[model samples]
Target: MSAAWSAGCVRARSMLSRRVGAGGARELASRASLEEVLQQLAAGPYQRGIRPGQSLEDAQRAVAATVLWHLRVLAGWLPREGAESVRALAGWFEVANVVEQVQQPGTPPYLLGSLAVSWPRLARAASPEQMREELAASPWGDPGGSDPRTIAVGVQFAWAVRVAERVPRAQDWAAGGAALLFARERFLAEQPLAEPAVRRAAVLLGADAVGSASFADLRARLRGDARWVLSDVDGPGELWRAEVRWWDRVARDALKLLRTTGFGPDVVVGCAVLLGVDARKVRAALEISARGGRPLEAFDVLA
Candidate 1:
């Protein structure tokens, strides 16, 4: 690795060290109201994101923006290869922003820092079809069709392939893409696979694995880190738990690699990914708390 890459990794590792843990998120979840959650956030890394008298929606948007800001700074410091991997990972944010714009046109923007340049065009999209066309010309590519849901999934699949190519051992993205395809086949759509993502995943996971009735056969077809997605997952109701577990395993493995390897882009990329997952967990917990639900008996901690 170059000296710049080494220095970037060191800086990123330092930043990752300050990320909130699962216990802190659970504490926020235990709060009786959104006000209390904001109070807790008032004194932490998320404090800057919490505006005075901020509603739950506003706070959530701020938190999302904060996570993107961290990623932006990390990407700016890394070498070309490292920056490429980080940008590839950040592409997921752009996909999500597209979905949000399609679903809620007038909503405030909470996009990735790297994608600020495109926000103007996306914000002006009069309809979902127009937004889809705009994304087609971008790195995210066409979502196979004009439908919003399909576009989201297609963008995700494209991102998975891109990340897998740019980052070594980044199998989690492919696994996630496969999981979504299987979920759609088994529970949501219950039809033959037609989307490009499903076909690509099928090449490695088998053409019949997605629609198969037997979970064992389906799991057996997955390779590398993708197989873990099916562990202990019985049906659609249990899929969320399975995903949380899978991400936990992926994040831990990334952290382990960061620990064992010498200075390189992997460390920077891994730190960004782990931090992003941590932010996801925090957001999930906050949503439950905002709903006035009880403390996380049904939720799996994502540290």
Candidate 2:
């Protein structure tokens, strides 16, 4: 790690320490309405983008923008070595942009903040073939380039590959790969295999391990470090629970990284991840509140 990367890590540590923990998130989640939520958030850093009467989707988008803006600021403090890791993480949003385009080409883009500069070009493609051709030179490569469904699978597959290749730690890579496999299998299990692109993504993401197979088989193929995520899952319906479990593991790993006094790209990545988790928890809590439920009753802090 260069001196600049270390310096960036130091700055990230200072910023991350001030993040709202579970207790604070619960307070935000306990609000009775969007107006109350806005008032509470206005007392903090989120007040700038979030406004009164904002719909849930718009509020979430604003929250995303705030998080990405923080990431951009952190990236500016790092050297290329540190900055590249942050950018790699942000690249997920680029894949998301493609997914949105495939799902709704005519609709305006919902995600506004992205580190990838080519998102505009990729987002403009009206059809799967055009999108695949546009992404031919990108890291997400072409996944047989057929239709929107196939292109979506290909984009997700690309993300799985990048997670394994770009993350610096071997253990973290294994966890991430396992999470992808679990989510993909659970989700695609419902989709008909008549689509060739979906079938390809299934194979690439190891979805076959869970298809028409017993939980025993699925558990056997998972990475050893990640097997615990499925210790309680018995069937497909329980997969979302397993996802939350995996997120807990991720949060723990990130917290462990942040605990160190040292500074580097890993610290920057940890801060970004922790902040993202915080936002997700807040959203989950607020969603529960919107549904006339109390905070922390439905969702708990993973870390």
Candidate 2 global TM-score: 0.83
TM-score of each: 0.86, 0.83
* Candidate 2 lDDT tens digits, 75-141: 8888876677777766656767887777766645535343664676787677877888887766567
lDDT of 1 by residue, 1-303 (tens): 788888788888887765677777777777777777877777777776876578877887777777788888887888778777777777667766777777766776665666343555666767878877876676656666766667666666666766676676676655665665566555656544446757655644556665457555566656645666776676666666776676777788778767867888668767887787778767766776787747577445433
The residue-level lDDT of candidate 2 at 25 comes to 75
Off by over 4 Å in 2: 106-114, 145-147, 170-188, 192-215, 301-303
For residue 186, model 2's alpha carbon misses the true position, in angstroms, by 5.7
Worst 10 residues of 1 by lDDT: 185-194
Evaluate model 1: give its TM-score.
Answer: 0.86
lDDT, residue 116, candidate 1: 48
Give the per-residue Cα lDDT of candidate 1 at 65.
73
